[model samples]
Target: MNALLDLDQLRTFIAIAETGSFTKAAEQVNKTQSAVSMQMRRLEERVGQTIFVRDGRQSRVTDTGLRLLDYARRMLSLNAETIAAFSSDAMSGKVRLGLPDDYAPRLLPTVLASFATTHPNIEIEVVCEQSSCIHRRIQDGRLDLGIVTHGNRTQERNGRIIRSEPLLWVSSAHHSVHCQATIPLALGTKTCTWRAAATEALSKAGKKYRIAYVSSSAAAHTGAVMAGLAISVLPESALTSDMRVLGEREGFPEMKHCDIALLRSENARDRIHNALAAHIVNALDNVSGGAALAAE
Candidate 1:
């Protein structure tokens, strides 16, 4: 039998599977696209299995690939733990993390789990709030790090962007809210990024809309839409099966992309902060991929 799979190859495989594209996988792994393709071909040859099924411009993992993905994650995790255990400076510090309430449910579990495993001695203090509030806390030095949704497309010097997804108009599948002459909206608080973007898009398109329901909670906005009270604007990642996305065909204006950014304080140079930030980025990647699958 061939020797055990190379760790680097396994890492590359995982990246391709998670990212859903070879170009994206190359970016994640810091390899050329051709190199990544070569690695995948080599991996398949060694395993004697076809892992990914290629479509026109997309690739889907085969059943065999899905099974291998589970093992790949476990192996990489254990490899990381084993290396960290022997390292002289084992991470041992408390980290203050701020996240938006809307993202907590979808992103927290994977981040916390992976960080805890790698840095068992590090204690994570998480605060769930709105993105604007989290940005304020980070700027005030009250938080060591935070994940926020920024309305602007330009990158900030103090923040790193994890991903950017479209802000979309969504309504209840059971409602004809989109057809109303004056659109009724279920929006967030005045400080909410999505609310501001939605209104700006509507105004630019000469569309008339009314804020029919206002709440600070994502659940509340979703509930309002489900109750057919109003249509809501939300990030693509926040969409669910029951929500119908309204596009140009439905007369909805195009909205700007929301950037999911990681903000770090001056103390970000510390090992603990760096480790946590990496974990957060990795977790968000998985969450984004899952959200894409869910939307499909």
Candidate 2:
């Protein structure tokens, strides 16, 4: 007979992969380090596959582990949903959620609506800010959860990657601004990862550019781009019909992929928090090639 895959072991495995530290995973799952290791060993035995390999001091997930992750998440989500549907005790509490305005327009509707329908008793307080601000709030215990852009090393250390998208050089479809001798740019504040990527790409390509507008708001970037004031770098989802992507043929270098991640506060361990986070992961994980004018 085939061995059964235990839900509890899969839960521990997820914590380890997301936290990227055995000790941290142990803490998150309420298990001792030795117990966590023992559970992983049993999990490997059941599956007959090596899922983890040591990298320096960290245990990195193997390719097989990565393949298993999607199924694990789906299974856990369904299990939680099923339990919540029939449980005598319904979950209720306030969850402080944070994310940039860029994502709010697109991601907020779906995630909020779904969560509200299933966990009606729960209240959610949302904060819209830049990725840096969201990370600070998560670390400071002011926010229960955050969906943030992956760029800062400090933030990435504790972040669980949820999605990735291409970063493209975008210009107004009706404008020839990208062909200017000194390219005009509309970008986020100096601290923004997208801005850093855009400037670095231009500098490396030996292209001259000027910062024409600076704002942390995606709407502001849209305004600048639509008015033929400047070109900007945005995630593929953030592009609108009025915008066209620029590339190497247009003298723009290819930018790096943008990673979106979920960050949870240390104090958020209750059932309500877990439910909301899981709901968010499930909702966002299924979004692919969605056409939206939202930002990171």
| TM-scores for every predicted model | 0.78, 0.68
* Candidate 2 lDDT for residue 207: 100
- Candidate 2 positional error at 245, Å: 0.8
* 10 residues in a row with least lDDT, candidate 1: 287-296
lDDT of each: 0.79, 0.83
Collision count for each candidate, in order: 0, 1
| Stretches > 4 Å off in candidate 2 | 1-88, 288-296
Candidate 1 residue lDDT tens string, 143-251: 9999888655333445788978888899999989889999999888997878888998899988999999988778888889998889998788788888899999988
The best candidate in terms of TM-score? 1
Model 1 misses residue 185 by how many Å?
A: 1.8
- The sequence of per-residue lDDT tens digits that candidate 2 reaches over residues 72-121 is 76677677677777887989789999999878876886577556746767
- For each of the candidates, the C-alpha root-mean-square deviation to the true structure, in angstroms, is 4.3, 11.1
Model 1 — TM-score against the truth? 0.78
